[model samples]
Structure formats: C-alpha cells, structure tokens
Target: MTKAMLLLKFAGLEFSEDRGGYHKAPKGKLPFIDDEGLMVADSTSSVFT
Candidate 1:
C-alpha cells in the first residue's frame, strides 16, 4: 500500500499513507487518498465514480 501511496505522490498528488483502518471504515483495512480539499479514496471504485 505504501508503494501505491508513493506512486500517487510521484504523480504530484497529495496522498495520505493511512492504511491502518478508520473508525468510519471496517477493521483490518486501510485507505490511500489525495486529500487536497476533499478526501479521495484511491481504490478501484474510484474508476467507477
């Protein structure tokens, strides 16, 4: 997941390396995102959204 974060960072996007699950999220999960003005969960769903 860190690699994925790095990739986004290289792309000039501000992403957070918080793959340690969130209270609003499920357990044993993590999220990568580009939190500039809004939170963008960098996942497969992103393609569809």
Candidate 2:
C-alpha cells in the first residue's frame, strides 16, 4: 500500500487516504481510488485509468 501511494503521488493525482477503507474495497485491498463515482482497485489499473 505504501508503494501504491508513492506511485500515485509520483503521478501527481490528488487522493485522500481512507484509513481502514481497505475492508470496503472490491477485494479487500488497499490503495483503491474513489474518483467521482468510480472505484478502481489495484495500482496497475488505477494508473492506467
């Protein structure tokens, strides 16, 4: 999750850390993004989106 955060930081995308939000993720994962009305899980997919 740390790595993912770093990557998103490097990409210059503004996002908030939802502490303990992993449980609500699609697959119980961290580093998910809730952009507008879309939720993207995983670093790779999030980057591309």
Candidate 3:
C-alpha cells in the first residue's frame, strides 16, 4: 500500500488516512484521500485518489 500511496503522491495529490469514524479504515489499514476529497481503501482505489 505504501508503494501505491507513493504513486499518488507523485501525482501531486493528497492522501489522508481517515480517522474517528466507521468510514475510516482499521488502524493498520490506511484510508487515503485526494485533493478533491475522494476517499480510497487499498491500492485498488488509488486510481480515484
């Protein structure tokens, strides 16, 4: 997942691991966000990020 996140970072986007809610992923599972506020789960969702 780190590798995937790096890719997104390279694209000049933002990724935030959601917290304080069910929408957030597990402690270990990092949910990411894009500049436009799009949320993503795994590398599978990185496309949207």
Candidate 4:
C-alpha cells in the first residue's frame, strides 16, 4: 500500500489518503484509487489512469 502511495507521490500527483477500513475495499485489496468516481483496484491499471 505504501508502494502505491509512493508511486503517486513520486509522480507528483495529488491523491486522497483514506484511512478507511479494509473490509470495504472493492476486491479486498489494500491500495486502490478513486478518480472522478472511477475505481481502480489493480496496481498496474492505476499507474496509467
């Protein structure tokens, strides 16, 4: 999860840090991204989105 956050940080992108519960994840994943209502759960997909 830190790696995903680091990826966003290193890219100079602004992302929200949600200290939410793990039980609410889309696919039981730790690191996911929400962009304009679009959900990104995979690490690879997030990089391009």
Best-to-worst order by lDDT is 4, 2, 3, 1
RMSD (Cα, Å) for all candidates, in order, is 4.1, 2.0, 4.7, 1.8
Best model number under lDDT: 4
Cα lDDT for residue 19, model 2? 87
**Considering every candidate listed, which one attains the maximal TM-score?**
4
Q: Which runs in model 1 stand beyond 4 Å of their true positions?
A: 17-21, 26-28, 34-49
- Worst lDDT window (10 residues) for model 2? 21-30
**Per-residue lDDT for 1-49 in model 4, tens only?**
5777889899898888887967656788877777777877887878776
Error of 2 at 25 (Å): 0.6
The C-alpha local distance difference test score for the whole of candidate 1 amounts to 0.51
Question: Local error of candidate 3 at 22, Å?
Answer: 8.2
* Model 1 error, position 42 (Å): 6.9
Q: Is candidate 3 or candidate 4 better by lDDT?
A: 4
Off by over 4 Å in 2: none
Q: Which pairs of residues collide in model 3?
A: none
How would you encode candidate 3's per-residue C-alpha lDDT over 1-49 as one tens digit per residue? 5776678688886656434655454334555443455444566656653
The TM-score values for the models, in the order shown, are 0.37, 0.65, 0.36, 0.73
- Worst 10-residue lDDT window for candidate 3 reads 26-35
Which residue pairs clash within candidate 4?
none
Name the better of 1 and 2 by lDDT.
Answer: 2
